[model samples]
Target: MLDIIYKYQNLLANIDEYIEDSKFKKEYLIEQLGVSRATFYNKVKKKSFTIDEMVVLSTILFPEEAKAFEIKEALRQSREDSKAGKTRDHKDVMAEVRDKLRA
Candidate 1:
């Protein structure tokens, strides 16, 4: 619990720096967020973005990190599914992939 709290605090503290260092333009972010420039700045200054908003911003600002996280999550879920005997045969999977590629 404390670790989670600390991580959240760290994110909030460094969000402005992240924005400044991001490759994305501020205008692009504002458009994507559907917020006025003033509103976006106010939220960043106050660290008052909601959890959903933070998720969106994080996904936008750190797409590679987000993708890696998703891949890790998928791997974890696949492991759990395999343990539960939810596995598909390799040959069948490859056949499906080939069919999709041909289409």
Candidate 2:
């Protein structure tokens, strides 16, 4: 959806600014990511982090925003699945949930 696209674009465009403005210390972030400081700086400068690295860093630096993005992405995917008739019936879903809760 447009919201997901807009958020993705904003994240891609402002990742560097986000890193710079994060409350976490760069050294701590580097340590948490298990990357050398130089490598971290290089990646930030080049915007060349791997998807795994980006996911970890984003979760650490912007937990709320990362969660929001994930929820939006899930909703978008759910909409697509619904349009494709890939969704289970609501009664079936509720039954499954109740079964799990009982277990």
Candidate 3:
């Protein structure tokens, strides 16, 4: 439960940063998210949102940010798996590094 909360908080924080960086107005975001201005404000104030809402907002409002979030989540999962002794093979590590470099 705590992990879920933390993940939501991180996503919300990232969304806020993206909004600021993109110079998006709150009214625009509300419209994009298909919510009333007051509803959007209330959700932001309470930091409570459904996972579906998050995904939808991320997908439609800021696709680049959504991709960034996906990458971040992949990296986090890889780290956690490594910590649990699920480390990848050396060749896999090299391949991943090469892919990153190529990117």
Candidate 4:
């Protein structure tokens, strides 16, 4: 278990290095990320990625694209909230979401 976790950590670190060194290519990097081929294809077939995946990929493969996606803006907001120790009440957020959906 420890070995597997260590390997994964090393893999993630190498990915970071590749991103910084501009050596990451889509196919290669995606493979190197160590997700299963099925997962990769499913994500591709779905034509969408989770926010965390988007953040990592865009922040690496193309920061300009990330900026355009407003990831930086969202991160900035998160940072500000952290600094101020502010947090959204989940119930409030959920109620707003429900209200917006109803509208």
Q: State which candidate has the highest TM-score.
A: 1
32-85 per-residue lDDT for model 2 (tens digits): 889999999888888788778877888988889889989999999999999999
The number of the candidate with the highest lDDT is 1
lDDT of 1 by residue, 24-102 (tens): 9988888888899999999989988888888889999989999999999999999999999999999999999999999
lDDT of candidate 4 over 3-94, digit per residue (tens): 97786455444544445467565566476546776776566565445556645665767657657768778989999998998988999999
Comparing candidate 2 with candidate 4, which one achieves the higher TM-score? Answer: 2
lDDT of each: 0.92, 0.86, 0.78, 0.66
- How does model 3 score by TM-score? 0.46
Write down the TM-score for model 2.
0.57
**How far does residue 34 in candidate 1 sit from its true spot (Å)?**
2.8
State how far residue 81 of model 4 sits from its true place (Å): 13
Error of model 1, residue 2, in angstroms: 0.8
Residue 47 deviation, candidate 4, in Å?
2.0
* Global fold similarity of model 4 (TM-score): 0.34
lDDT of 2: 0.86
Candidate 3 off by > 4 Å: 1-6, 13-18, 60-62, 65-103
For model 4, where is the 10-residue window of minimal lDDT? 11-20
Q: Model 3: C-alpha RMSD to truth?
A: 7.9
- Cα deviation in Å at residue 34, candidate 3? 1.6
Which pairs of residues clash in candidate 3, taking residues 3 or more apart in a chain or in different chains? none
Q: What's each prediction's TM-score?
A: 0.85, 0.57, 0.46, 0.34
lDDT-wise, the better of 1 and 3 is 1
